[model samples]
Target: MATPSAIGIVVSDMKKALAFYRLLGLEIPEPAEGEDHVGITLPGGMQLMWDTEELIKSFDPDWTRPIGTRVGLGFECTSPAEVNALHAQAIAAGYESHKDPWDAFWDQRYAQLRDPDGTVVDLFAATP
Candidate 1:
């Protein structure tokens, strides 16, 4: 069986990428500037890896971002309040807001934002 271990994200700015994930509770260390890649395993045991654009271009010289949201990622917040809080923090820090926090029909509090590279990041929590 092939077990899923990690997700790879190619980013334009490593610093901003790290900061965004850090704000989401990932304790990523600050690497010396311009490191090719960095990663952190999540609480659920899934590793999230970041590769700088330069690193990707090193191998795939023709690599380009897919049109539209290439990949969607969701983080499970501890509570609805936490979801709202993180959403606001990301927005205030100038991240793009795709959706404001709200109670969804699926019974979860949810919000969405775009990372520095414009990846859709979702914040969600089950309704109490």
Candidate 2:
């Protein structure tokens, strides 16, 4: 069976994107001059890659950034405190918190924030 692997994200600027993910406590590999990309190891060993426009355009010529609209990427955490901590980290890293971390009606602690490219990331912790 084929195992699930990395998710790639296209970013307008590599430097800004790198810094943002670094603030999330990911170990970013040193970028190579011609690479225009960086990878981060998520909590569960899943990898996430950030690609520059030039690199992404090579894959999909029509690819473009979504502006003025929310496209969220949800990340599940082990606990509510973990969710709140990540939300705090994002806010401290100079990003605006779209929603303060709070217990959801559906029994989860959740919060949202926007990345440099306008991508919203949802941090969620399941509550029993």
Query: Which candidate tops TM-score?
Result: 1
Ten contiguous residues minimizing lDDT sum, candidate 2: 1-10
Per-model C-alpha lDDT, please? 0.76, 0.71
For model 2, the stretches where C-alpha displacement exceeds 4 angstroms are: 1-3, 68-128
CA lDDT for candidate 2: 0.71
User: What does the lDDT read for residue 2 in candidate 1?
Assistant: 21
In model 1, the runs with Cα more than 4 Å from the true position are 70-128
lDDT of 1 by residue, 1-128 (tens): 12234566778788988898889888998988669779788888987878887886664476676675434576777789988998888888988887789897668887878889877677878898
Candidate 2 lDDT over residue span 55-79, tens digit each: 7466446656666542236677778
Whole-model alpha-carbon lDDT for candidate 1:
0.76
